[model samples]
Target: IALECILLLILQQIAAPGPQESADDSPGIALAWKAHQIIRSRFHLPLSTAVLAKELHCNADYLGRVYRRTFRLTLTEAIHRQRVLAAEKLLISNSLSLTEVARQCGFSDTSYFRQIFRKHTGLTPAGWKQRYCKEHINS
Candidate 1:
């Protein structure tokens, strides 16, 4: 339920027009939005800018540039963010080990998963889980 709410919020943010963007969306904005949807749906898979661009029938560089410009983040960062969000929910709601959580969240290696998780959340997966559980249990 928490994960669903977060996903919905992210989608809403992506769909909302930015201050500089007009009501009539540009082609790049449209493409970026499509990319965002694809990232959300297929986040559990091995995703890359090349793979996404191929699926979206656009050039990889163009897609990367448009996605970065539209969202102010790189495509790889977006994918990592989605995976980390899902990982956070799994960490709290399941008894899965860190390796299992990393695999299930589309991270190819546990160490890499830890690195990215800490980058985003400022804590290791286990640390984040422990802190979160402690905080919620006391509430």
Candidate 2:
């Protein structure tokens, strides 16, 4: 339930226009943007707030706070969102199994992947794949 709420909040944020950046926060906002870019490229690897903070040369708490302020979502939320989006692309035309998709998306656990996928898209991975397969037989 907590995960569902978080996912919903993230979706809402993405759906809505984002907050404008304050001049005072330009540096931190840049850091957050860079962090997200890094996450997109390396999200399939084991990543954590501490690791991201270290990479960005900022305190973990500070990074989280600024990122949340700038993006209205946490780093973890962003990561999970990216993973789910990536999984959606793969599921469209790929024949990978659930486990493989999870692994490819940096989810170490298949069940966790399913849970996040459901929270993000309101459908389990299998259900998503089934629906897509039926709609697009080219896969």
Clash count, one per candidate:
0, 0
Per-model TM-score versus the true fold:
0.84, 0.80
Q: Which stretches of candidate 1 lie over 4 Å from their true place?
A: 1-25
For residues 1-139, write the lDDT of model 2, one tens digit per residue: 5985796577445534347544677677778777877887999998888999999899999989878876788999989998998999898868888899999999999999999999999999889888888888755
In model 1, the clashing pairs are none
**lDDT leader:** 1
Q: Which stretches of candidate 2 lie over 4 Å from their true place?
A: 1-22
Which 10 consecutive residues of model 2 have the lowest summed lDDT?
12-21
The TM-score of predicted model 2 comes to 0.80
Worst lDDT 10-window in candidate 1 = 7-16
- How far off is residue 107 in model 2, in Å? 0.6
lDDT of 1 by residue, 29-70 (tens): 789989988998889899999999999999999999888877
